[model samples]
Target: MNPEVNEDKSSLYNKVVEGKAQVYFHKTKNEVFYNPIQEFNRDLSISVMNTYSNVNNNKKLKILEALAASGIRSMRYALEIENIEEILANDFDQKAVDLIEENKKLNKVESLVKSNCDDATLLMNSMSRNWKSKFDCIDLDPYGTPAAFLDSAIRAIRSGGLLLITATDAGVLCGNGADTCFTKYGSVSLRTPACHELALRILLQSINSHAARYSKYIVPVLSLSIDFYFRIFVLVYDGQMKAKESINDIGFFHVCPECHTFYQQNYGKTVPTRGNVKFVFDSTSPYDLNKCQNCEGTLKLVGPVWTGKLHDKIFIQHLLKYLNTKTTDDFKTRERMIGMCNLAYEELDNPLYYILDDICSVMHCETPNHNVMRSAIMNCNYQVSYSHCAKNSIKTNAPSEVLWDILKRWVELKPVKEKWMGPEYRLARILKTQPKIQVDFSIRSDCTPESKKNNLLRYQEPPPFWGPGSKPKRKAEDEENSKQQNEKNQKVIEELK
Candidate 1:
């Protein structure tokens, strides 16, 4: 489990203070691991752990930071969370572990925080061999996909323990590379506006499938798709039957690439009888994706993603409620967390969301305000909610046909440009069809969400040109020379222009 490498940094700070932990690193040379923007990520994790401890009988917890980096998160856990027996902050790089050691001492949490320089997966694998030594909670915040560690993570967690995972490979998970997504997460990701939500589901299914191999199953507590990555929290429990039943949540997404209509079909079926519900193999109907039922566009298959509930309603409510306690008053991301939690709590259990703009773009019509769209959906007596992932998102139970019907009615009032009305186009196929129901666009008071009404930070804008910062180049001396050379080259090019 030990690694041998040049102690080169995935870099660290001169002195960066976050929460109650103050970290000190030897050099600021080549930046790699530390991200100040993730302060919100840290605060959210602490709040969730606090809520978890409170909800789970205040049991003292043993935690593992699988990729500890500079140990900021571990140190924060040791300080902020109420009941913490110990934390093992492990990183393969010797320098990172050394930095962790120094920061743990600096934070004055040496007793509760331990630093380990070993391969994270191998260390967890070894711990998984000993049933009693498994961690109560394990956090995986790797540079890219957490899929590499998911198997060991699933096996290394104690029964009913929390598993926090982060995946930042948004490009692959959002469908730019479906094959790569399959290689990492064993699912096909689709390119759609709801890609973030799709990414969350894909990761959840990946973890659940890995757990299924060892007769365990996951119960997702909260799942979030943040600015550049996906963070998911799920509880692991040991049960052969429950693991078998996980198939009910495993499914594929059928999408119309042109129009962005989607349908979710699970591998298992729910059979509800007089007084009981039964889970059975899906034998009655097998979907054949030939064309979009709404616009006759080509149907593309994208899945097998987790089709189950992304968050436990009660748990999300508990998290939102935890923010109000006096202990969390110092949280810097408190308002943002509150807004996200409110959205997650209000989010429908539907599989995917439609962007109102994306839908209207097909018709070349003006996009209705989200409130207007919300009111229209409610007027049709269908349930709807906002997905926390995207603004202008419409997560609803209404079928695509119904949605097209409403759009058809809208076009009747305010027609689209004649140039877009070609009979061969998807727009024409949709609008030429007759409306099935009486469409209503009357605005409703309840259409405005509570989060919006209170002006909570529902959609915080990322800093301009935001990204995970780049890795530091060669040495400080070489970097200086390269910078000068690039500047001189740029000056010559500018003069030529």
Candidate 2:
């Protein structure tokens, strides 16, 4: 068969991306193809893989991309990363399989990367049954929730192997679809300013619960919330002691509907164990409140989510080091990734974050500068750092009461011009009697100009027709624009050569 004839028959086009691999994908519709916006996601994945490989010192690494769409990820891994023994790229759709085969050949990695057509779950289960713990890395980047494939994928990975999972069902995980989250992830989610962080925790909790059933446990090396989804890289191990320790990380939350004061309760800690393996509850601790402490309003219970450290500090440092040593042009999101790594490295291991806007809104005062708030919190001898989940959020170890007191003091310094009436009057009356505390109003230099430069790299304006929804069917103009961009990139590559 003539290659040009075959390509013409399917109306497929070849595009080289990230300076690494050339892939064949449909132009008019992305329903059965690739999404260019996910380049950051892929870049980070490669960096993590490189770091993990170096840390393990594995000379022959095996990888599995369970839901490989057009085999771009697998091809990139084969071309860009080192020490790869094999890559099994699987997709259930025959058309996708055909494209994967063609792309695999196009990239000249047919000997290293293999394409298979089968249901992802069944394929993973078969691998487990045939060769248990065979893969050094297993990637599950399904279209939506990866919950369905977690069980099988966990069983198929070698002990100490990395498991990469992505969940795009932010609506459910972020609490917009509470019932759906409970049904799928076996946890309750709350839609709050920190919902993105909560979403990451919820996904971790679900993975832990599933791994526990097979005497396995996961230690999250890196957990991040990026555009449109959340991704986690965890190292899975097998041991009774490890599984028991994993149980200790399982916990719940108590959020006040009125003031948004949130509390966390771990299973074995706050929820004490009784003689018959039952829980002993006490009013003074975990079950301490039926009403909001600040406003005397009802408190809603929110979790059973993971309350462990989201990112391993040392691992993040290593990832940054690896990126720094590489001179490859494929990592287009390098600066943005450095910014994210810097934040993750410094962020406190606290469970939840506080939104500055939310805090000021509650206090009925103008929003204070983030640096001022940070300085004030630090003056009180509490740790604070910027949260990667949101731009105006900070994760601090300061108690809610202390935070409220700081806000109350700020309000006193600069009184609200709006007349005090109704809830505002009630709040002012309540805050006036609180103990007065002095705060340093000096500006903080936590984030430097260099850090801002790194962050600015990730802030590209979206396309004119961008909106929130599933990946849309590309129109003719979209395809033409993409083709032009590809040509321009190729010309740049030629010039460099």
Candidate 3:
């Protein structure tokens, strides 16, 4: 029976048995066998499994799959992850529990897997006295928002525990339905080209802030965007410093459409900008959108978001090594997982300008001018723009057109402001007048030779990618180039003297 058919087959849904998936209906004596849709919950469960399996030294880890639904996720954890010692699958539905029980027995893994019929929220809330600090990994895959279970989930995970949350309600997070997200998560979602990423960041920030309210801190290890679901894995640490650090890294901000301006104040730096124009009425209030002056586009207000980069290269490399040694088709989903991982990895550092000059170096892709490269990178979801001043381009996390507008403002101003104030300070003042740029988050892409030298100094990569040949060639080029650059610097210094 096809579960999608929705013919009272909820209890009789079939599952994979052994390597080949077999569907056995308990309600009827008939056994139907066929391949399942790749888009089913099972596929998601596999992705979740593959991610956690990347966790190192999990031998003593206690894993919980709250709202275990079909218990497929729990079973995957129990059977696949050798590091996981204790696996708990909890669901309020007694019938689902029974099915889980049967599934565990069918796989002959009853000893490793435990099935419980109880409210997942209750189970998580009781961790204070019942489990205290027992669990290491808590998976929360709910039917919708997952906000209702957040409080309990936070309490359940131990210090240095891993919390994997999945929110399928993308509409709310993307600001398509802002009122709903505000009511549910106490966060304002923004609508923009980067809305998808903004939604995930807001959800992560909500979790971090919610955890901090209880004196907890969370450092995100990996965040993935898969179809309609948003998955975030965070590590919980105990201590006020940890809590403050986590909260400090995630924040809220607003953008103005009319002026192509934005205002972002970190957790500790909360001073309101003193200017004639103000996009944000409240310093710590929810985010909102306004109208753009230049283009008349509705400015998107984004945030209540995370600031830290997503994928940890160390973690990804470890997982890649593990995959290389494995002889199973289990690595089938590796391509998709790696794609998301690479995106997160690339975004870990402060995103810099992909100028026509730098594009060839970073991506090894050639372009004619800043205009063409800017257009291409923007199409690839990267914010890119051009300038005629010291640094001729800038690229960052904000949306492309928004950044372009800011660049235009700076261009018209022609190196505006006092020489004493830095780029960020001058940019902030410029944003004060142009409220549209005030709401977007951006960083300077002014890459000097010294900075480029520093970046190359600490560049890390796979063996073949960063082998002797790679650096030797670049080192030879840099040595010869460095001499000329030093001479030019000396000429300027002598002229100043």
Candidate 4:
């Protein structure tokens, strides 16, 4: 039966199976919610938690699925992840929590999982008030943006705890609604070819800002721009000194609208000393931030994004090691997990990326092969890699001058049919000045990344898309009923527990 269809008011539903658990979803009404396309999301969450469990085997985990509409993910965590002491499957709707309770029994994980009905933010804030009530891992995968619950979620996790966040409001976070993003996340998001990655950074910066409220900071274990949403796993730790260091990670991107070249301006800087690196913030500007140095076009200033590393290299290496031991049936998206992790590991330690096709479009030239472009940049003695963010992305430490020079060299080899040599044409404006740096188009043997050579699935084949704020909510009365149930949910939790 289609999970989205509404059937007769009778208690009729279909059983759905994913990973190691089966749960019932209403064929008619809103007792609980389920989306089969989230299998990859659930699988990757399990894989990451399993890896986290292995790496931190000594500690027992207290996990909370903050928005457990169907409790499928919470059940899977109980059944699959190791070293777990207990799991709280929480939802605002009492009916959803009731289904969670039933599913816990059906899955025979009754001892490990408990159902709770309460507003997610209220539950988390209550947990934050007590040291023992705080969770070791908190997963928030609400329909649209998770912004409404971030502060409470950050405060509720234990130090060195893991916080998994899912954001499906791609429109708001991807620059379609800059004012909304700023209102929701306290950061303005811009439209760019690398908007996915920008979304990741914006979310991280928001979480990081929230973390600072309690003298805590985040270390991103894995930051991904997945199919329909952005899923990020970050480890939270508390220390005033360490929290102070997060300043180095906060920054903005100055993008050239014409040529698509980007320059990052970090809010803080770190200067290498003889013994220890000194942390500095509000430092003097290193790059001319007023305008695009290359094209002289107006530079659009974007973000107060997380300028720090998106993925933990060592953690991803171990994740790949963990995936190598798992079978396809064990995790259907295992290859994708491994592939994405590989690409994340190989990504240059840089902020944002330029899409090759977008750049070629600006130059009005034939698109050069990724390998050839990558080779030219690498041959220039700069590290280069594919941002797990985009297929034709160029993520390198090469200065904009070298990249523009390479494009000039490409135009030299395969010239544009017609050059619109006018001030108005972006192409003319970009190529008007001679390339100051030498560019070599010599193809190298290792141009293709290992992830590509191995035929790994580096990009997503997105599931059915959802518009902004759309996650299959019920009609108005049902939503109001859910709200009323949530308002009084906390009062009845004692009986459920």
Q: What is the per-residue lDDT of model 1 for residues 366-471, given as tens digits with 9 covering 90 to 100?
A: 8888888889999999988999999889999998788888888888788899888998677877765688899899999888878889888898887675665543
TM-score for each predicted model, relative to the true structure: 0.91, 0.86, 0.62, 0.91
Superior candidate under lDDT, 1 versus 2: 1
Expressed as tens digits, the lDDT of each residue in 1-497 for candidate 2 is 22542746345564656549888775645545566767777888988998898887745679999999888899999997778989999988777788788888888998899988999888888787544447889999887789899988988888778899989888889889888999888899988888899899999999988888888889999998887788899988878667867767778878876567788777663342564343333234544677666666577777789999898889998998998876547587787788787777767898888889987877678898877888888888888877778877778898877777788789878786566535545465446457456776676665333445454443334455432334434455687899999999999999999
Model 2 lowest lDDT segment of ten: 275-284
lDDT of 3 by residue, 393-445 (tens): 34366553454453534334344334423534323433344434422223234
Per-residue lDDT tens digits for candidate 4, residues 68-135, read 98789988998888788999999998767766776787799999998888999999999998769999
Candidate 4's clash total is: 1
C-alpha lDDT of residue 228 in model 3: 59
User: Quick one: best lDDT, which candidate?
Assistant: 1
* lDDT winner, 2 or 3: 2
Off by over 4 Å in 2: 1-10, 14-16, 28-30, 130-133, 270-287, 421-433, 444-497
**TM-score, model 4 to reference:** 0.91
> CA shift at 491, candidate 4, in angstroms?
46
